[model samples]
Target: MDPVRRTPVVVTSALLTLLLTVLIVNLIQPVDAARAERTTAAGASSTSTVSVRRFPKAHHPSKSASSSSATKNQTKQQKPDPAATSAHPVDWLKPSQQVDYPDPAAHPGLSLEVSLQDQRVYVRDGSELLYTMYASTGMDDSTPRGSFRIQNERGDHFYNPREGMGARYYTSFLNHGVFLFHSVPTDSKGGYIKEEADMLGIRPGSHGCIRLTVPDARWIMQSVPTGTPVLVK
Candidate 1:
């Protein structure tokens, strides 16, 4: 072959090889870029899943904790007041003196009902309550619990020397002159005993007698007739 022909052929072959290498490099660059994009997307998705698993929503109190708090508030509201159970006196007078009594003659068929639990007397006409009176029945259930009738025995004042206590306006209800309705306890000198009188309508303190205020005993001694029904319990 001639030298010129060989040089042209070699040059053509070199140009063809360089063109093929450029085409292969272009195709491989696009495929590598696509693979890199897919790897970046997968890494971002895994990072997002980890972030969601690490942190949770804010905390809240459980149902039992809320219920316990509500129960404590209700218990505090339901507690009772200590002062409401007892009576308070007005000024210097006894608790019984603050009460108003009804006239005995106006209400027909009057009877007496005594409550040991409340330490009170209810004056009733049939089923109607006409008046309420503060009374001290007896200590340790000494006052008899049953129905009885008032006797014809009564007095302005009397003292039992053995017991060293006395009362005014005594009206016999049981055992003739043994158990009576009378004013609060008095000394031998006829002055009121402060300790026993203060407990009227609050607790039982009498010695098997129905103890009333001065005016209440006086009214009963004067107005209430003999054989009046009295129920004590």
Candidate 2:
């Protein structure tokens, strides 16, 4: 059996460079040929046949001469000069994680409010519910009812509902970070599943902070502002 012949993978620009190189070599052939004729006319002895074949130069093209400078610049820019390539490998990769931005001003001067009604969180400014979504709180650790300010906001998370631990968006209203409201698998979307029932009834709930869907988390990040008051109950 014959072994498979692997093909060389040449980048498009490299291939283009090789083509231009060959073309330049071809264009300059006549000049050397003319020079060789002059040498012969001057009574020069014959050198090696290989040497004779090497310098059969021809007339160079003005068109290629003009375009060479532009080609060189293009090649320089297209080639990732090692330093830049090593600096950021994932710069062109697909975005996986979403950034979180918490704002207290979702409701303005009164501050932001996170209320757990039923089994969901009702984000509001004052009396109006800005956004409504499902959540889960601590089974033994009931969500505290208090008015607090957002200490800080995070963009990265690594939460796992299986271990009662992972990444979570924590608000200053809780003892620790567990009260964070991020995303969790829902039992049902709109099947009359309320907040408090699903929140602490089954699975891994929260410590106290308002629980939110992943989408809801991102929404709140955008809607709310930093340094705003967070009233959780």
Candidate 3:
């Protein structure tokens, strides 16, 4: 016979080995993907719970049921690939704004104070913050910075004389009684007298509502309503 070009045993075995390795990798890939997916699911669940508890329920679903239907279709039609889910981008997150504000003004009010020295509010009866907001209490005016109380109580505009300019903060929820803590005054949105402070953390000035930043005002409005005790010492 002519010089036989029979397949060499070594070459044949090498080809077989390569084929088997490829098959094994493909077989285990699904299991790896599943494990990764479980890990991702657990992390997402934990974050969702913390965020959801802090907020009110989403009232008033879409007027169009079709929108929800479309969402369902999108969810069911294609699941994300487990391996790529980690790399998938989620750019937006729910804003971590606070509640527990003095929203119920008509109902009654609480003594609200925003501390310039410690950046804290002191309510009469709570350990953890029952209600809070960033505020500026009588920056320019000698709005007594020590302790005071709801010397009187009423609802009025932010610039109302509010028991006089030099009043002290005390244990009352009046906007400007003995002390001043008003949501409207702290309204960065409503041209509510921006403080002289350069930073935006707490608006840094107040005729008094303790002059909280907008977010802090919102929180105070949500939590401490009228008649809530406040202690500014």
Candidate 4:
């Protein structure tokens, strides 16, 4: 028998290619798994951020704005009364000696009477008395007692050289321009002399003029006209 020959085994191209393809697929599978894990982690982080940002905080008014609103509401609630803004008319008959006057249209209309003894002045409309007020007349019988008409109505105030003081609302008498119905003595600049206000209606305290309260003097200047009858007794 001839010597038996051993056959040599050889790798074919198709088998080698199949072996390489299987090895490449095994390596790529691990890379794909790692990429998928990273993608899932990024998706989870993005979803968490979106969830936190979805709802916003509520708004509140600032401190100054709240304070201003409160002030406005308080002003509306505590508004001042309209009647308080207007002054009430003076009550002229509060004194016990007042006698109500007749209708304002009576003939021989409004007149004035000055009583030195009583230290009072009276306003009359025709035969009826209208109002009476305490007064300060001349000291030492200096205020002349006689009937006289107002000759002139001067300024709201004037200067008196003899008294070295000022007077307001001069309603001059016809007998002598020096004598008049006026307010209590004041300074040269028309400021009230508080000392003179204290002496009013208590006794005779003027040089010669009839001294009245400031309001009474102003009322006479406004209402009483020149040429009105005045009787001083």
Give the Cα lDDT of each candidate.
0.85, 0.51, 0.47, 0.74
TM-score, candidate number 4: 0.53
lDDT of 1: 0.85
Ranked by lDDT from best down, the candidates are 1, 4, 2, 3
What C-alpha lDDT, on a 0 to 100 scale, does residue 224 get in candidate 3? 47
TM-score per prediction, in order, is 0.68, 0.39, 0.35, 0.53
Candidate 2 lowest-lDDT run of ten: 87-96
Q: Which number leads on TM-score?
A: 1
Winner by lDDT: 1
Model 4 stretches astray by more than 4 angstroms:
1-107
Better candidate by TM-score, 3 or 4: 4
Query: What is candidate 4's CA lDDT for residue 124?
Result: 84
lDDT (C-alpha) at residue 96 in model 4 = 21
- Candidate 4 clash figure, as a count: 0
**TM-score: the better of candidates 1 and 4:** 1
After best superposition, candidate 4 residue 78: deviation in angstroms?
Answer: 48
User: Model 3 lDDT vs. the true structure?
Assistant: 0.47
Error of 4 at 154 (Å): 1.8
Off by over 4 Å in 1: 1-58, 62-71, 82-99
- Candidate 1 TM-score versus the reference: 0.68
Query: If the candidates were sorted by their TM-score against the true structure, best first, what order would they fall in?
Result: 1, 4, 2, 3
